[model samples]
Target: MSDTSKPWNSPMPEPQFDLMRRILSAPSPVGLEGAMTYGVLKPHFESFAPAEWKLQQFMGHAGVVLDTHPGRDDLFKVMIIGHADKIRMQVRSIGDDGKIWINTDAFLPNVLIGHEVTLFSEDPGAQGSYRRIDGGTVEALGAIHFSDPAQRSGEKGIKKEQIYLDLQIHGENKKQQVENLGVRPGDSIIFNRPIRHGFSPDTFYGAYLDNGLGCFVTAEVARLIAEAGGTEQVRVLFTIASYEEIGRFGSRVMAGEMRPDAIIAVDVNHDYVAAPGIGDRRMQPLEMGKGFTMSVGAIASEQLNRIIETTARVQDIPMQRDIVGPDTGTDGMAGVLAAVDCVATSIGFPIRNMHTISETGYTKDVLAAIHAITHTVQALDALPDPHREFRDNHPRLDQAGALEHQGSEKPETADK
Candidate 1:
């Protein structure tokens, strides 16, 4: 889109997924969850990531902030924002009477009680509830209370009180700004943290990388396709899902919304470098620099697996196969259940100490995951309708259907 010489035909050197694996696998320090999240979210949020160049063609504009890191100064700062008016009903502590109290003075750490703290909520109906209070006074009898000991005891405890912000603009001038920009009170607020490329160029860390890396990969694929003049009949939806760590809620919602012909749920998998329970025997042993792992189990359809496997073989991409046994416990579950004709697959990086601050992955796995996913998508796009039909009628399906049709089928068979 920028008139740069497109390397659509020229064989671009396959990224060394091994390098990504090594970098991500490095022992991260404590309190670096933000680094992980930032790693994942940065590509989606900034134009500096390689994928931004391609996304510009499809989205018309890259949905990324250009000036992500402004100052060279370093200071450890953390800002927490309440979600909409839910802060209004903020519950600080359990009261002696077993009731929750509202603490009007319970302002966020650095901001003052009456200060305008940015509030963000995903709910559309609750976005406009911001209101400023005089020194942030809470109703003494209200369900929220402050943590200050002086305010507690008589009727309510300051520790039991919580403060809520009313973000609604009351003045006419403020109303005009809202009308022009479409900013409203339940509108979700996002705080921007300067993207800090660590002091060492070889090492960097920040927030939001959990599934952000997957989002980045998708963006890069989109860019590659756009630069190749785009594909015919296939549309890719690069989604930045919410609530993945909490409960795969974003994937569920995305699956329900798109009901795509097929789905590939990309996320991180554990790399047992330092951990004991995981090894090469039971769980597919993944090295930090090996590449991406593809899951094999009931959750992944044979057809999709074959397609992915074949593509990787042809492209000479390094990949590992993981057997998940009965279930994968991934967003792939939600994707499979969303539509009758859809198939779901998993592509994951090797992360160590998952769900912890020290969670690590190799840079190689990241690059490998990107290659694996792009190849899978291309393979799927190239398949004809008849191929899909044949897969549905394959012997494996017939045998399974026959077992179901015949009441003589056994419930379970133990491994010999």
Candidate 2:
């Protein structure tokens, strides 16, 4: 609805989509999510705000805080945080011969079989890159053919434990050879994939599109605000949190460490209007090239929710909502229950086949998401401070100061 006038045959903007590919190309499976946040996203934060940006990481988790306003010092802030972690695996053990064994919470195990993967380094502090150790695959159905169908476990179909990492290196001592290359029993493992275009070519395909676009939009919103000369007026604490795919652990750590006046979480949802077969629209809507969505669920921050809704309407950003849930099942929940009890809300793009390799979405939705987030910050700047009302009434609430924002701070130093 925004601008699909450019025919489907038209090529996407080279520079912008290339950057999205570079971002989605980085591996941040599960526990190593913070690595991608710092190593991949921090550069964009710096490129967008340079002197005003800062970063933080803890136990493989990372946060990129953009200090748009170096002039003012206040706990009154808004954080656009998204979980940067994707469900990935760890090298559990290896077979004496050349076969390998792995363990992980692959949400969709069937989708992983026969796909490529990477064997990353053991150093928890190391950033994940494509060059680490490539050309690994999960065992296939016919390759490891079972005699009987009943032998499979009903609890977790296509058990990842039984699935082996087929490095396919020819030799008697394959384990020893892989180990010599720094692949260890405990090294982090992730799906090794390059970002490719979907069938229409207007949409992008890859793993972690679930929140990859969310992380993209969060930082892009800050960049957009800065571009519109709205940064100083709208100070957002942008964080690329980790472990969000499995749990809200990264954001939990972030909330404990810093306090913001309001939190607007940017994330993704599997709300394609055209699903394979479905009765409920709440599950997903039939949308592809339209704008993004907003949640009208229990956890929405009243002030922030109304502001986003109004902004989308006034700006005429094409979108749909009513994908209601109790707490958004996102880091937005962390913002709702944080120590400061700040106002929290979420706006996200809808993606199809969410956790699988073929996850697809339109750039139009992505740009709309970026616009919505930036507009949220800009709109919040115009409205009353949602957190200020609570502060006036409850002076005894535990107050947290912003970490050393500018420079020369211990943990405040950019972890990149």
Candidate 3:
């Protein structure tokens, strides 16, 4: 029984929340994520990183790595990754009616209707320049009177091909009018809804909580580790990746390049406790305001998980166990995909309505993830020998010894 009447306030400090807001506000749609990574995260990283710390920039995408100790193979390396990209729509074609047909990438069509969006169009006249259009609204058949009976009753779902953006162009020569404004095919469109406080305390709901929250957690953890005088025995690579929404290509590339001994991928998880229509899947009841989640299955390293769990317990930080089977469905698989030969696990906070215009999260859970990861890194640094501990401490089946009978000591007759 929690207080429902309580007003919501941000759990993070003003500056931290401002940083998070900026990160979330910066559009980092799939193929074009540099705006967020290079524009926001790079500056944030540089502001607090020590003089000896190295900031590694990528040659292609906006993926970046902040290394506490560069070129130190002797030290145990740990890479903490969080992708910066958000799922977005791309311009497919322009209709003569002035409707911009779009390819809805990773979004359900029903969520796009009537919501305002920002179209980032590349300047045709200037090779690298771009223009931003902020007044467009995504639409389908427009009014309810135009919808078919099946569509009105929700029996038929909206298709991605049917989705288009309306920029309020009228009269004739609509296509020419759009082109004149530099709007063209292949432009990226993102939800213009900014993140803000929810009705509940310490809650927030808006666009792009999936991975922007992940990057925010990673960046905050990096700041914490830096302020703690840095690690002595471990070289930490704090990475903000790109293209995770597409296929985790950027994080896989980072893993291949760094080849760390272990990786902790921070990302968002579904708040299955509050998520609707997921009861048939029988997922664990993970929810917001429950601290952070740590991966328990999949390619998640058991030994590495032990370190994080122990850190959480020792630090008295609230945590939830997330069971991810076969694949983590996150950048946690970057090491495996790149054949990096490293232990890997995922850390996250549960957020409801993922991959939608109004994804929601709890700031307390985010702060918990930051603390958990920071302490885990410090715990690794304090270890006598990290490589040997992880290599030699794998769970053994023989360690359980023999099982004893719970009922009778001797065998009983078949029919007795």
Candidate 4:
């Protein structure tokens, strides 16, 4: 619980907050992120980016990268990437009764029912142009009275195929009206919910916080770095990627092209402390207000983690160590996937109810991440030779010291 009586003072400026809202609200379904990346974020990046910084646009996807020192391979290249795309439902088919069937992507069927959504329909008449259809609510069977005994009881679960959207259409020619409006298969559908402040101070909830928050953080960090006169020894690439929800496809392509020396993948993490029934499983205790999360295992680079953590400690920024192993499960794997041989790590704020229409986050944590990453870049720039630092900082087994032990040299035969 957080204090609500105190007057709300935003951690970020009003313009930045407005940008966050616009970026999160923009329709950016997987593989169709041009509305978000190109339309919303690109202009914002151009507004404050220094004159020397170069904006890199991709050919295949709507990914954008802001390079602090373009074509400077001598300096250490650090890419901070956040995907601009979000998971969403796609129109699969239309029923004669005006119901639109959907293939729910990465969403629980129960969380979607009764929630309003906006469908971006591709017009059959005009290819490459889209139209927005609003005021539709996802539904299943309409009423509880129509449900079977299992559905009423806890014994049954809602299936994804059973869900459909209702536009309140009537009359005999229902499907015709829908088709005439250009609502067809493959159109993107997203929650029409907008980002709004939560009951507690410094908290906000909305749809698509999973990676919108990530992109917002990346943009803010870049702005902060630019405001501080930019980095000296490091050529930072502030990158916004696409298709992260489907796979790390877009990031892999970006990494392959840029071939940065290091990458910091910014994304959202689960607030396991606030998650329901999470105590039943072994999970890290993380929450919205606990501050930003930094990865500790897997492909997380020790040198980069050291720089970030040391900066946090010196700057008194609250941070939580997240144990991500085998794979970071974010775009941190993009470097490895692309065979770029770059050191990588992930930074995020713990979010509650991820992949839902009501994903929640704390502003303080977001600001903390911004400050921490900004300072870490500054620290990297201050180093005389960052490439050598990362390459040589790995622990050497030869320098190991033995701990005092009270172990009798094994009577191995007797133990066996």
Write the residue-wise lDDT of candidate 2 on 185-212 in tens digits. Answer: 7677677666787778578778777677
- The CA lDDT of each predicted structure is 0.44, 0.69, 0.89, 0.89
The 10-residue segment of model 2 with minimum total lDDT is: 1-10
Candidate 1 regions off by >4 Å? 1-208, 277-281, 386-416
Q: Estimated TM-score per prediction?
A: 0.51, 0.81, 0.94, 0.93
Which regions in candidate 3 have their CA more than 4 angstroms from the true location? 1-10, 401-416
lDDT for residue 51 in candidate 4, whole number 0-100: 89
Kindly provide the TM-score of model 1 when superposed on the true structure, using C-alpha atoms: 0.51
RMSD of 4: 6.4
| Residue 391 in candidate 3, Cα distance off native in Å | 1.1
Ranking by TM-score: 3, 4, 2, 1
Distance from true location, Cα of 192 in model 4, Å: 0.4
Clashing pairs in 3: none
Compare candidates 3 and 4 on lDDT and give the better one: 3
Better of 1 and 2 by TM-score: 2
- In the range 99-142, model 4's lDDT, one tens digit per residue, is 99999989999899999999998778889888899999999768
| All-Cα superposition RMSD per candidate | 15.3, 11.5, 6.0, 6.4
